[model samples]
Target: MNLYRELAKEQPYFVLSDMQASMGMDAEAKRYMSENIRSEWFLGMILFNTRLLHRAIAKGVVFAAALTRSPDDPPRTKIQFVATREKALELLEQWRAQADGGRG
Candidate 1:
């Protein structure tokens, strides 16, 4: 858990595995989400090769920007689930288009 807390320091979102074929989401991860995330706006994108992590999407941080698709995965709405890196990047561009939206 300490490692994850340190990871949260580096970015708005952090991928839990390094070059693994897949990632596993567990209760400990959820605990970290509750204690670590704080987003006044949208949370950053998390690209994973697995569907088990979707449960984290409800953490109350903010937008996903997009979650790259995993076939056999269930349909997800209200949050974007992309099919590729290019698609995720495109969604990011679209999401930031409104920027702050407070200026005239």
Candidate 2:
């Protein structure tokens, strides 16, 4: 989280997270992290090589984002789950293009 805060000091950035070897988070930790994430500086994130359970949890987070975010606020972090690194990179490129106003 410190790293994220430091990076946010510069500019909004996207994260390509490789979760293949991750031990996965519990509900409490997930809630804490989600509550702490500042949408103003988090552009988006792609989780690649995640386990099936993690993918399902990611989907829930996406749903929560849609429900909790206000229409008046700037875009929140867009989270995506992919099976492979190549696909993750492809999606990241698309996100970059979108963030760049289609200039990327």
Best by TM-score: 2
In order, the Cα lDDT scores of the candidates are: 0.43, 0.77
Best by lDDT: 2
Q: What does candidate 2 score on TM?
A: 0.69
- TM-score for each prediction? 0.40, 0.69
- Residue-pair clashes per prediction, in order, are 0, 0
User: Candidate 1 — what's its lDDT?
Assistant: 0.43
Q: Which stretches in model 2 have alpha-carbon errors above 4 Å?
A: 24-35, 59-71
- Worst lDDT 10-window in candidate 2: 33-42
Every model: Cα RMSD to truth: 10.6, 3.0
